[model samples]
Target: MPRARNTGSRSPARGAGPGRAGTPGRGQGTPAGRGQGTPAGRGQGAPADRGQGARGRGPIAGPSNDGQQQQARAPRRRRFRPGTRALMEIRKFQKSTKLLLRKLPFARVVREVCQDVGGVDFRWQAYAIMALQEAAEAFLVGLMEDANLIALHAKRVTIMPKDVQLARRIRGPEKGFASL
Candidate 1:
């Protein structure tokens, strides 16, 4: 066992009453309660006795322009989906009065689509490709418009598969979108 240190003098724990002896028992804390050496939160002005909230500071203000304070604006977000941007560009092209450009799918995609859907088409014809391209463009336009409306209704910026499915239902009865 270790022996207590001897300094030729002894004192009660700091802030303990003069009548109390030895250090305070475990978890008993100071005789007066939680705020040992400081005053308890009895009133708003108790800080004077507790020694807190003494720092003198003023409200922080950012840099100003002239006499008018400038408000920060949120940065605009750019859409990432290739489909949305392409559709927007297509709409812009359609609205232009100066030039009318016919945007059709590349021959490779058309051939692949044919082989997958049409099948047994060993020989490709120009008229057949043109018809398929037009139909595909029409289906895409209706699908995107419907799906965009659905997403907007849900207060979301992203188009989900469910939105596309809903769009398909809307376009199911339409003549041009019958294939969809």
Candidate 2:
């Protein structure tokens, strides 16, 4: 428990009749309702009663001196560390090539064969996998183009296996590319 505040002695007027002056009671000084308070310009006035509304201290809401509506602030830009742009570009390239590889029929087969190589600790990246797939596809395409030419030269529309063998032979064995 705490001790009550000792206001010294009580004045006679403070405990006087209800209608007496300088006393709080049913008198002319009592406020009526919501619209009643101390007169204006004495202290901080109520927002509803002020001439400038509630935005007295803030920037006025209207067009500027240039006769244009206030422009909204632009969104913040992304900041990257120094030398990280190359890393970001490499990741982007990997992602794009990975997406392209998804559309190729031999992508899965090539990835699996490289991963399943025996007695080797070969690790495959997206670039390496894509490189191998592209080289193989190019070799096949060139060989087929040559075989098609050979067939055309032979007065035939269909290419036989011998045409492909001849094409490979013409490419020579020293190139390390074996026959189909």
Candidate 3:
């Protein structure tokens, strides 16, 4: 008979099983550490892994690639509604009128009205102040009416006549009479 072919001995290849060795296989046929070694150190170092981890943070953290693409394509936003815009124009008019009245010397107007209107030597300053207050009230009431008209027609049109008049009265010649 032929020799027993070492049937009773355990082979060294069998001892290289995964659990028995500390290092796993490297590439296809090279030894464990010969080429790129363990999976952890093969590509970039550990610091690169940490840097990737840090990037995935904050409120929008971990949005897939597609989500970021969609956000970039979104549109811009508008700041004001038609009704609010009308009111803003009226307010600008009111402010400018008040500024012009302030620059004029109302004391002279008061002195003249008192001297000319009443012979009893009444206070003209008080009358001038009252006139200014009445003018402001009239302007405010007109603005309110214009605002109402703008609101009533807001859904159907872009401009209202009452609003235009108010703008003209307040802005005078400075604003080139821009209509609402």
State TM-scores per candidate. 0.39, 0.37, 0.23
- By lDDT rank, best first, the candidates go 2, 1, 3
Clashes in predicted model 3: 0
The global Cα lDDT (0 to 1) of model 3 is 0.51
Clashing pairs in 1: none
Each prediction's Cα lDDT score? Answer: 0.56, 0.59, 0.51
Q: Write the per-residue lDDT of candidate 3 for residues 1-180, one digit (tens) a residue.
A: 552332434455532555544223444343433212222334433332222322223232445758878688878677896589888887897676453344245556655767788765555456567677567556656665565566566663544666666556666665423544
- The order of the candidates by TM-score, greatest first, is 1, 2, 3
Name the better of 1 and 2 by lDDT: 2
Give lDDT tens digits, candidate 1, residues 1-180. 664543434344453575533333335533322233322334332232343322213213545454432335555687677688887887886796532225344567766776899776667688876676666666676677789899999999789999988888766666334454
For model 1, give the 10-residue run with minimal summed lDDT: 51-60
At residue 70, give the lDDT of candidate 3. 69
Clashes of 1: 0
Q: Model 2, range 83-142, lDDT digits (tens) per residue? A: 699779867865763433443556667656766876455656877777777777567767
Positional deviation of 161 in candidate 3, in angstroms?
A: 4.2
Give the distance in Å from residue 20's predicted Cα in candidate 2 to where it truly belongs: 99
Model 1: lDDT of residue 49:
31
